[model samples]
Target chain A: MTNTSQDRILEVKTLWHYYGNTPALRGIDLEARRGEFVTLLGPSGSGKSTLLRILAGLELPTDVNVMTLDGQDVSNIPANRRNVSTVFQHYGLFPHLNVRENVEYGLRARKVPAADRRERALKMLEQVQLSDFAERPIARLSGGQKQRVAIARSLVLEPVILLLDEPLGALDEKLRIDMQVELLELQRRLEMTFIYVTHSQEEALTMSDRILLMNDGDIVQTGTPEDMFDRPNSRFSASFMGVENLFDAKVVAVSDAGLTVEVNGASIEGVWTGASLPSVGETICCGFRSERVQIADDSTTSMNSLEGKLTSHIYKGKYLDLTYQTALGPIRMRSWQSHAAPTETARIAWHKDQTILCPKS
Target chain B: MFRPPTHVAPASYMSFVLIWGLVALLPTAGLLLWSTLTMENFQIVWEPSLQAYRDVLSSGRWQVTIRTLEIAAIVTLIEILLAVPFALWLAKGTKSAGVRTVSLALLTIPFFLSLSSRTIVWRGVLGLNGPINAALLQLGIIQEPLDWLLFSQFSVILGLIGPYFPTMVFPLYLAFMLIDDEVLAASKDLGASPAFTFWNVIVPLGLPGLGAGIVFTFVPMIGDPVVPELLGGGNVVVLSASVQSLLRILNYTVASALSVLMLVILVAMISLVAAITARFAKGGL
Candidate 1:
């Protein structure tokens, strides 16, 4: 999101970071408008966390040409000096202090008046719905409560941006869902920039206005969840977003009408889902989500269809996770368990535009 | 523990910890009893009199008591103030354990040598013909060798610092090590300067250990004979030396009373300081 009248809340140009001699983050350029909930989505060691730390000024970047906050340069500022706060994993709530005192820590550090600090801390505690536990020692709070206190503490400082490093990672399944809802609500209400770091694809998809997928210290793709899952730009992005069926195919022809690709010996016509179609004879990775394919009777199946023997199938409540041995390779698909009986030759079909084609990883 | 550690037997370990204390403390209890007894006229009779207590109170042993308190208070204060920062550096400055071990070993090298040898070394270092005087003379920083460096209150204070400084460091280092680095980093992230972090986080967190160090240094220093006897060299007469000299002349009654009084005062002073520290900490940071 951008506005002509307002400057970017945070802007980074050509950022690089290294741990010792090994590069943790390769050159990265990024800009965030005010109130954008950007998710840094990647697996472990993918440099997502490192990038977030650099943005928060917790770690110094190896080199940065333009690191600014609200159009002001903040390259040399420390974490304490920068107008950003973080809700670190494990909560990082000071155990020796009560909830109220812990919430007021930043205010106290800035030498805010005693009365103002206490009143503000109380107000923040109430906002997090922990007013009753203001005087309670942090050790006594439950995991979810601790997380809320941490969020409240970070927000009370009124930072320009808040970085959350898997804040709900420690919670149980039920609590995580609840916190996810609460956090998204908070992010919307606060109207401040948020850089959320998480490896959970579901979390990244659910909360992010835009997801920046990272791999091997490089950002692979940046798009909305729909764009990522439906039409990924790279094989890494496609597979990382949970594509179960991938096949190597050579393009036979490309036109405005559609593109045809030859897989093994079968020519499959599929609408080109990517922005630019591939040239004839070029090899590309064809990926499809398991749930996107449709299994049909061989007699009525149309284009983008393949005939294969059913290898195996797994009953997974709402859908049957089935694999078929086709001429190209074994391809997996999610079929409703009620329609599938284990032993039969089957025809699997999908729409022309459902094929996600990308360059090889 | 998820699984109990097999090697340690709580029964045996607890007895070793508790039984030794009992065995050591029986003598003090006996001394307290003996302090109330006196030999009447020429007869060896069990007659409890306030005479020895009165003599202890009247013979100006209170001066020795006050002097012992002054020295203990000064030594404990300086040792803690110095040791906490050094211990913090050892525990947090570097991630390497080897550095801490080597530094601690170097700090306590004086303890490896006998106390007498260490005291003798201090004497040499601070003496008129000592290395310090020679260096100063050679550099022409002073025309005369400093006389008060050795055999003065200064020497007593200086002498106790080196040997007892480690006592403060050991406990404080343990406490600081117990603090999670995340907690400290979080403090700094929340805009606390280093000094504020130390006061608001490190001090309260490390207080119990520091309080123990204070006991370790102060309790012993209050009645310490070696420092006042050897290093002080008659320029200072602390309570311990007073107790020793009283015994030398067969003044057993007065000696016993003096020892008991010093013990009581030391315990009371330690308790008072502990109470103050506890109150000031307000449970924790």
Candidate 2:
């Protein structure tokens, strides 16, 4: 299902925010389609949380050209007047209100009748599998249950957009993975636009339909998780997505297939993955994922190969991480195959298509 | 395994409890006993009787007790209404640390001054020819100086509010400060207006402080002799003033009876507040 303008639930244009003189976001544009799970993936202070807060109307941007929610201009609306709700990182449920009462608060604020409020709150609690916990105090809840209640409290309002500010950050690893699945399912069933902000790349890859990779107050790349993982467009994006074998190279030759780059007197062939290809003699960065490398045997006839001395091997449960000292620097590889005894000298080979070129900066 | 040393030993704990009982509880128990005795021929009669309490009822001293409670309740309510928003502003609304520190220092200044010294200043302000009446007359609001301005129950209540206001504000400030900012943001994000958030989230979460403010302001206000003496100008008699008059006549039994009655009223009020707070703690406001 391709999303067009008619499907866009939230649109922000030319938004900028500053804390006094320090800018947090520098004139960024964002859009989310109906029922789409868009993750703002970035490190702390990358403006992801600031963008979410602006969307939820909890924080006003320093300047904005346009902001629309569900086809209406909401640039001037306060948080309480907007049709957006945020699930805070700490699951800021009211300690003075019980589970169901916390859920009913938004409805009550909107002046919904008492009977309808209770019924709707109970229904939302049941959807989160917390029907039995409706009367329990917030202090009595576990971390995961509190997260569900936070989500339920926001969803009970039936807002146009739901903003989640690292809502699962406090949970343990297993529970966090489980909650990610639950949240994805919940968003799918509700058909509500979800704007989730998190710093974990794996979480973005696992849960997002589209990911916006942010760095240094700007969104450096936006694409599907697979596209972001395989075809990062910048040095920042490449390293952020776990591409460990990155080297500075000078382009020596360009062809229809790819470009040949020289790194430390070694000619390496890498695909031109960017929108525009650099001409010969331009300096650039080349990278490839460690899992894409393979140990080349004597019988193998791969032209793209590197010979280096074995440095170290770490035995991970699922894969072996091997590092080699090469002319270009240390090249790391993750191998899933059961390898033979380590040799001092080894040949590591990768396909040209697996190589990615990024801007050196 | 290494164990942390205990802070209080068993013997010390017992002795501390004993000392507290001897210092605090013994006097109240003695007063309770004294209230049940009778006085005759200007001598102490050790026989237990309810004649002192009976005399208090017949002599119309019970009216003073009821009136004192009414004034205390009214002043506590007024302080609550005034202090909650001010405390909220001091704790959460204001952004400047300097402003918060200055405001807190201002609230605490009254505690450093004597109660009589602070209360005596109000007499000059509330008197018939005081600036308040002069300003009212100058503004064409009143035709003549209002004689009932200083020496009435109104002035007594007015005088009591300023001395006890800091008590109400301090606890509320602490409570409001402890509330997390994200909880408030979540409330607004969930579509609660500012007013709704105040009543639903801020007030309910501030119950412990509200209960404390009420007890701190109300209990002391009921027994305040200085404000009534200075502002009431001996025109309005409350329980404390009545107890003093009974003592002056060497009626220790009746004085102790009045003190015991005041204690009963205060305990009943505090218990009601504690019960309400406990219920809300389990459920919600």
TM-score per candidate, in order? Answer: 0.89, 0.92
Compared with the true structure, all predictions reach lDDT values of 0.84, 0.90
> After best superposition, candidate 2 residue A107: deviation in angstroms?
2.4
- What tier of docking accuracy does candidate 1 attain? medium
Q: Which candidate has the top score in TM-score?
A: 2
TM-score of 1: 0.89
Clashing pairs in 1: none
Identify the runs in model 2 with alpha carbons over 4 angstroms from their true place: A298-304, A337-341, B1-12
Candidate with top lDDT is: 2
| Local distance difference test, candidate 1 | 0.84
lDDT (tens digit, per residue) of candidate 1 on B63-92: 888888898889989998899889899989
Query: Candidate 2 clashing pairs?
Result: none
Error of 2 at A17 (Å): 2.3
Return the lDDT, model 2, position A83: 93
The local lDDT score (0 to 100) that residue B70 gets in candidate 2 is: 92
